[model samples]
Target: MTTMNKLNQVILSATLALAASGASAQMRIEISGVGSNQIPVAVAGFADENIAPQQISAIIKADLERSGAFKLIDAGVITSMSNIDYGTWKAKGADALVVGTVAKSAAGDYEVRYKLFDTVKQSELSQLNVSRAPQFTRLTAHNIADDVYLKLTGIRGAFSTRIAYVKEYDKRHYELLVADADGDGEQMALRSNEPIISPSWSPDGTKVAYVSFEQKKPVVYVQNLITRARTVIANEKGSNSSPVWAQTGNKLAVSLSKDGHTQIYTVNADGGNLKRVSNSAGIDSEANFAPDGSIYFMSDRSGGPQIYRMNGDGGEAKRVTFTGNYNISPRVSADGKTLAYISRRDGNYQLYVMDLASGQEQRLSDSTDDQYPSFAPNGKYIMYATQAGGRKSLAVVSVDGRVKQRLTTQAGNIKEPTWGPFMQ
Candidate 1:
């Protein structure tokens, strides 16, 4: 069996944590494949960027390219908007254009401005201007990329969002890291000699609830990103694992083996008001919340593990997935219309997305050992972890399976990626 199979078989097991440590280097991305129909766009180098701390246009270009939504046409430092030849760009096969300027203000801040143009129509589409400290140059570039993405695709860009995953150096060394969507700007949230898994972000993107093995057993904890303070949410006897935040952010759904068999339960964020939600005799773990207050999870009550759903208060339990004999890790999209999960097919575990209303499903990944699927805030993509050649890394695939990207680190193995919501 593959590592994913082993992990899923013990999905309800307890998992890691030590004291916080310094941040690590960013994860390097190797994006491959592209959408069948990509928008052709051009981003020119920002004027006066030589004095800035970071190159704004280059960052924007990389962000857009990694998204697999745009085909970047090199503009080669055409920094002046007045010099943009729409006709020339159109003839060069660029349907859209982006040009910008960066300058240091007298008050010691960076002023950034960018404009989007429709080369086909020879008209300006939209523009934005912002001022930020030198340290936020990369963030400013990401914001501009988000604006451009929203303007062109009608979908909110997740470039400004964050993701959390566990990096495993060995059985005795692990770290929970939070980083930007592109995998840069990494900050260590927790580190330990034991293992950590199931890092879930709060709806507001302020706190993360994860299962740690600090006490030599599985326990759940919530950590504040700002102050680095944390509170134990669940350390009940037996295994405590897989904590997912509710939409309100005050409660979480977790799987605990404190009872006879591993089952699902809802607990207050403070680790109070623990309420059992799943009454299955078989293992009922990996509970995830839908937007409508329904809980979707995995259970083996029917003789095999399959996806099931119940009301928020654990009423009227019903099975949701039938085609697959083994389905774990059900991740509902923000809109509650789609579900992403891992399924075993022909002895290989792959990522799959299902339409809640239509009962139709499509496989999204081509890898053999994919696990822990997490949806982007926009629901346009799903990020998951897959292992190949004995090495584990993170991968993202468009909902339609047209685009794919691979993210790897300089050292260690990364897994259990949880994409964060749009920051407030």
Candidate 2:
């Protein structure tokens, strides 16, 4: 989540091997596991590489492995592509082949060309094309890999998407940053020596709304992504934070304390016409919208943070979750079939996704700690942050919990990973 977006630029650069040149930049979750079945495949090195100094194969291998797909073959463990080539890969259990070439353009730009070959059929399967952008050519490998992923897997690749997260380098200070989904090219959106928390993305994916303490107290501000321009969206005398964008694309369901208790309120994106949604005395802070025009939230009025559902129009909320001791962060999936949240299981905090209809609960992780799960635009995956082995990291898991992927590097502690709107 921390480097989720910035690393999209240099996912396949050799610099990652050195673990340098990406302090503020992004890289992907480097996982060490082979797929259930290693497909027979070989990736030839790029011939005309650029100044990246490190080769791109390692990064590519990491992405493939993290997906729990494709088995990478070691070069030393194999012979040349031509010498024993005809059926060598297929015999070695390689079902595919990948080859690439890199070069510096006459205009001083970087370019990479890659091809995916189906070894079983002995023919090229697809072509993954990538062109570099300003100061971001290094991310070419991720784009290429993503293209290959979509073509082969029939799912939209997230290689080009961005991730929004909060970084608390100091215990009391925090900064809201956006980076590549793989944790490269991290840049600050807002920084405060005071505590900052909870970032929500606009429907247009062009701006972010987050709670900041830049003025010595907590306040919510809608920040422009391109211009870095920000204006106060909601700032009350009491606790005012935890914003969730509405389906209408203009209204934000936020919790305000200017009244007395932190109840749900609806206000314009520019901060005006505050209408109360919840009038309860207990906490109603974490709330998100569902696709079917209902609001799902957490409330301790039931003695614990039980899940509650209410209509888009303000009314009495109906409690939905009954089997949980603790539940917060109600994330409505794009399809609205499953609800993802953080809950306590076996005395540890873990990510949980529940079947909205059957109320069946499933824990998606077993780690030191996990928090803040945001669903991908397609609803196929959920991205969350985790801490394990005394290290902070970001991870992505498939909806059914079959595939779990760590998507961040060892750069900084990543918190609050909010997925962006569909980019297609």
Candidate 3:
């Protein structure tokens, strides 16, 4: 009995004016950029007792090469630092060289120090200092890698976030899955027979609010990982789906048909008296709360589904999209600077992002049937559902249309990947 809607206009506004001027357009390093420049580079492990220098070397080598900024030299081909010949690398067209060492502290922490050298200038490019516990070596490697990329290119790395998505094992069963930002470390929670949809994280990242059909009705439930306890937030007789948590953590904005029609409504996190936000009577669902409390939602009152925004109290709703015939599943970015949605192009649907300030729209993702694009807490990456070869799965892409990585272990299909609020 979970709120049932085959397809409702879920906040697919192509508004949000994105500024053309990039703050770091002339920057050096990047979180995601090309791995094609192929700057020939050589790196060797420094002496270490706590762990193998070779292990840390592998991490740095992979990260640099992944950036497409450098051509990583094979470990076997690396020359000794005693040789001290920059010409060998320079002659081999090496742009830079990296050398590092690892040490274990008495307290059991591993410390790694690395230096990036400019082969052409015969000078040091950057120095990175990193420390991590023995059990957290991978995290340390990620940080070290970020240090190197930032020192060289100047963009912050996003290797520490998580993506939440719905994975269907069968037509009647689905589970919410959490994976690494790169789609690693996947874990499942809350399995059910009816359709599960719209997993939204709290701003603090501790708990999650999603719609599940365990009771044979679409009901919004807020689940806490730390406690392994869940309380029903919305379980109306009709469709009660798409639960979005408000900024205060004590409230939620959700779509309900309890009043005989679907519209945006607000309720306490524990599920009580619903404060209806939209009363158009058309189809106002998928309410996403921006930072300032302005609710962004999808409504077809204008005849076709379009994006609209209004205050939390439900006054002065403004239309945001005038370009597409069909736009739905609008997700406002963490910073409320961008809106991501599934827009129909030609005959297929693709993910699109619009700057709320400028109303400029940019098409992203190549998946023909993509849906439910949500932003990470940092507003850098987006995860959504995509169909390929008639099979459904989850995928993520950068907002700029540069980097993309697909994540799923779906036995059947996957949908609605959302970045939970940052875990405090």
Candidate 4:
């Protein structure tokens, strides 16, 4: 279910406090399907990679394969970029090839170099040389993958970005986890015996704002990722949840029930200057910002939950969704050309994407229970929460709905995934 539902059904009744702890479960990606047109690429092993802390070639392969945009062909020990193996790769059904080298300096720094080749065209597409400490081996690989993906697809890649989500170990234990975009390298930002929901990343990616049931009421808190410090941003008399950052990163639009009904309110990031944005008597929550600074949210003013759009500072609202009687969790694409949300049909909640200009909508998920649709930073894919085999898990699908994959942790159920911004 969406955060708005949780706020009404469970926020007032749950009771617990948050504690800091280290995250334990490692998430694994399982590709359930692939796109009809996939670029077959072979990523060769990097020379002298043993000196690094992580395998650069394997990480790149996993990143690309997980995207469902590339078909991985085994390179089989080829590591040198100097050799002209274009004909060999082309005959082996690889349209493109990647090769690189890794060197460790005496002072413990590392130099990572990689080159992308077009086997059919028999030419080098791009190359880069990066220097970083040993701890950034995986990140270096992700950067290389991003470059390769962008060069081939003409769209920027989101491999180097991060993601935030909620993990529920049990009814008594809950955690807010930050991890890589691929769902690995997780760190627990906040842990509680109660519930935590609506994890939203700031535009600059330095902090996160979320609702915590720490004091037995849903209160909004902002936590710095670098220092692990948290501050209460909203703690009104009633429920305070569904905190989403504005594009400028200086303000947050949150759902508050202080007015007797949940409504959208814009508050300063430091918890000052609270101002109401929506004046509707009906329930209004799940506020999302579009690229142009307009706010898209869910409101039941029309007798059923539907998405509505209003200006940034509480103007007249115009309904954007009319096809479904139930629609919530309105997430806008980075370009503002598409909107991804959950719509109920045939007694099942599924992920749906709509073209803002044409009003054409398409169903993107085959599962019965899907929620929390988060777009990749590149806007080519969406990562959402869904139920698989009765276990809550994360799923990613291409914006075209041609590709799909399921991401599951080793131990617990994961939900409310918010994909972070691209690294500056």
Q: Write the number of the candidate with greater lDDT, choosing between 2 and 3.
A: 2
TM-score of each: 0.93, 0.82, 0.76, 0.93
Of models 1 and 2, which has the larger lDDT?
1
TM-score of 2: 0.82
Candidate 4 residue pairs in clash (backbone atoms < 3 Å)? none
TM-score of 1: 0.93
Model 1 per-residue lDDT tens digits across residues 1-424: 0011122112111111111346667788888889778899988898898889988898999999988899999888876876668898998889999998888999889888888999998898888777766766777788788888998899988887779899999667999987778988776788899899999999877788999988899999999775568999999989999999999898999999997799999999999999998897799999999999999999999998899999988976899999968998999999999999999999899999999999999998888999999999999999999998889999998998988899988789999999988865
Q: lDDT tens string, model 2, 342-414?
A: 8876778888899998988888877747888898876767888788866666788877776777765555566
Candidate with the larger lDDT of 1 and 3: 1
Error of 3 at 237 (Å): 2.7
Please identify which of the two predictions, 2 or 3, would achieve the higher TM-score against the true structure.
2
Tell me the tens digit of each residue's lDDT in model 3 across 1-424: 1111111001001000111111111101224454434456766655562264337666566556544556666534233344456887788766667766677878867776666777788887667565554644544555556555555556544454455677776587676765445454455656667788889877666667998877778889998755558888988779998898888888999898998889888999878877887989599988888888898889999988988999988997999888878888888887789998888879889999999889999998876888888886657667778888877876667677766666545356777788755433
Each model's lDDT: 0.86, 0.71, 0.69, 0.87
Candidate 4 ranges with C-alpha deviation above 4 Å: 1-20
The C-alpha RMSD of each candidate to the native structure, in angstroms, is 7.3, 5.5, 10.9, 7.1
lDDT-based ranking: 4, 1, 2, 3
